[model samples]
Target: MNPETLLLMGLGAVVIIAAARWIGARTGLPAAALLAVAGIVYAVLPGPNISLDPHIVLTFVLPPLLYSAALESSLLAIRANLRIVIGLSVLLVFATALLVGAGFGLFVAGATFAAGVAVGAAVAPPDPVAALAVGRKVGLPPRLVTIIQGEGLLNDATALTILNVAVAAAVSGHFSLPKAAGLFVLAAAGGTAVGVGVAYLVRLLRPLARDPLLANAISLATPFVAYYIGEQLHVSGVLAVVVAGLIVGHDTPRSGTGASRLQTNAVWRLVDFLLEGIVFLLIGQQLPAVMRGLAKYQTSTVVIAVAVTVGVTLLLRPVWLSLTQAAHLLLRREDEGLNAREIAALSWAGTRGVISLAAVFTLPLTTGAGEPFPDRDLLLFCTFVVVLVTLVGQGLTFAPLVRRLGLRANEVDEARQRNEARMASVHAALERLDDLEEDEPGDAPTIEALRGRMQERLRRYEHRLDVLQSAESDEVPVSEHYESALRIQRLAIEAQREELLRWRDAGNLPDEGLRRLERELDHEERVLPDRRE
Candidate 1:
């Protein structure tokens, strides 16, 4: 691309992303969908045609985006949902691919089973970035969000495995079930091992570096190394990146200084934002190309195929979720499973994005006999149609569904539990300070001051809890007292945090100590309920 064209695309992406973010906040529609729409509008209008190489996109855009997603993901939550994640990510994807492919091959088009499977694999996995973005805005319960994201992260590998096998079958005019299954296992194992090895190596090297910037830079390179190594070993690069990210994230406390951690977070956040914008924009930009390819088929036929594929993708989630929930209940008797609101959120959060586009674009343009790939254009067109429908249609309506289902967090209960925890902790700290005052005569003034602060914090928590738990008749007076106490606690925590930062800067405390204190303050902030009514 020319500099001017590149500049324009960049500028357009900024405008679209900004507008999308604003609109998404107001409407609860995913910003990605809006970005796609904006790109499509630009493509359809009179302007310099900007086309991107699929290889360039796959190599540059995908790696960073995937890495950023992995970094932000909570490994603890993911591990907790491993069973559900595996079921949806692997088994469900395989099932969906086989069924959808068979239906297409036998009924819709005069294609081989492998060709149908290819299409199925291409569209199977939901986009994690899109789903999580919309889900957070729609107030999806934390557990449901974990399940969706975990499934989304892993399903790409399953779909890709199926796609590779199908593509080989299509090329060689042969299919070996045993061989394919073995390859899938080998690839997964290879990726996981490589990721784990590289993650440990990165962790080992991180602490030797003194500068925060150097450590942050080393962290950045780890993902690409994991990805490239996996690819070199003929394994799943995506999975390798994910595994590496999880390892590093879990081990972050070991290597990262507070400054380094903050820097790394900011860098990844920027990378993620830009990549997401670019990915959606590219999806929209490809519409014209996809349409040109679909010109060979009757418009009605193409429309029906697209509609059926989309309907299957949308309907399959709820059906599968119900079955999964039923099985969980039978096996574990857990009532904490998804509620109706969460189920609805899951159903609507299934938006397709970059991975589907990458899979479609990666399809071969020529067949074994040197002729054009059979129905390649139709496949791309259908994929685009499905992406557009899910992103725009379901994305727009998700928030209203959340509101209708009354899925907001229980603020009163949350605040009360937080206050109780704070009261207990403060009481413990006061006792500890009393011991310190008796042990050291010279430190008596400092210990006494600390005890006074702890007492104040204890009173604040007590007052807040009392207000929240009070009878309605006394609520007004209790609430006023609670607000006053809360303000004092907030100010105290802020001051404490500031003092800790100064101590670290003055070399009076280690970076780890400051980080631990910061974490405590952050926990306090989370516990303090949003007072915005």
Candidate 2:
């Protein structure tokens, strides 16, 4: 395609993405699924369509997306659910691959066990983007959200490693259990090390990245650095990127200033929004490419291949979660474990996405001896089928499933906990003011003024907490006075912003000065909770 065509396609994709996002917000559907449908519609219309390049997706697209997710995820929550995360991310992926491999090897004609396993590996990891977006919107409980996030963050590494090992075995016509296990171990360890090293390197450079622009520059580069270094070292680049993101995210609050944090967050949000939307569209557009190689295979053969993959990929998750949950219940003395509803919800959330397509696209056309890779085209179709089925089918229905199961989060309790935390922070501030009052000479008026403001904030929190605790239902009780106060504060901020704009328009204030003052108002407005009265 020419540059003009590419540019037009890019712009077209943005338009579709924006439309999908708007529709999703209104209809409570996943934008990812919507974008996929739109792409498919466009693909079938006899126009130029984009084919997914695995190298481009893996190297350029995957890192930043993973990094952004890792940054937003709670490291502590993931650690708490580490066992379940491991079960889903690693053990489940391996088991699914083995099961699918066995199915294809025994049931599907002319398919090798290694090639079957390669397809299994491709479809193993669930992409958390769609699920997380819908889950948070529907107020899924924090524990469930953490599990999904943890699994998504870590599972790519496992699936990609298995895919690589399976591909190598298929290419060389050699398969050894011990060697495969050894390779997986080496990749995991090396990737983890590289990720940790990159995170520490970032920490050492935090002082230099204190400026918002510089911080964004470093943040943008961190994932690629981790991925590139890991790939160069013959380790798992996916794991490296994820690990670096998690560690850097965990340390971000302690290391960066408020402005840096704000700017970095805004940048990553835009990156994630654009990248995720384009990726889903890209996935749908590849239907033409995926279908092109299936002419040689018998109709029945293609149907059976698609069924084996779709069946194994969809059914294996719930069964695996049930078995793992049972095993945990049997072994543990603790009263805590996933109940039936939680398990059901988690099972339904296993929607595959771009990583599956990217991994499969990386499959080579020929083996080491120059023979065609067994069932290469068939495998691609199966992977694409699996992605389409899960991403669109499950993505669309997951929220409804959660609702049917009566699994919505307790928002009132969550608000109460947050208010309590705010109360404690205010107490700490008051204590600090006391110390400063004793130490500082001739700052009595300023300190006293600060103390009054802190006291007022503490009172507001206490009142909110009291109202929350006294609530009779799960819904948060909205105080009219509180809502009115917030609205007034918002209006005040808006008026100040208007004045700043007016000054800039009249040339009384420079653009830079106006921007600086407007930023202050933005932050102030951001601090207020949205009650949407």
Local distance difference test values of all predictions, in order = 0.76, 0.91
Give each model's clash number: 0, 0
| Model 2, span 61-124: residue lDDT tens | 9999999999998999898888899989999999888889989998899888888999999999
Clashing pairs in 2: none
Cα deviation at 480, candidate 1, in Å, is 5.5
List candidate 2 stretches off by more than 4 Å: 333-335
Worst 10 residues of 2 by lDDT: 172-181
Candidate 1 per-residue C-alpha lDDT over 385-430 given as tens digits, one digit per residue, 9 for 90 to 100: 8788877777667667777887665546655667788788888888
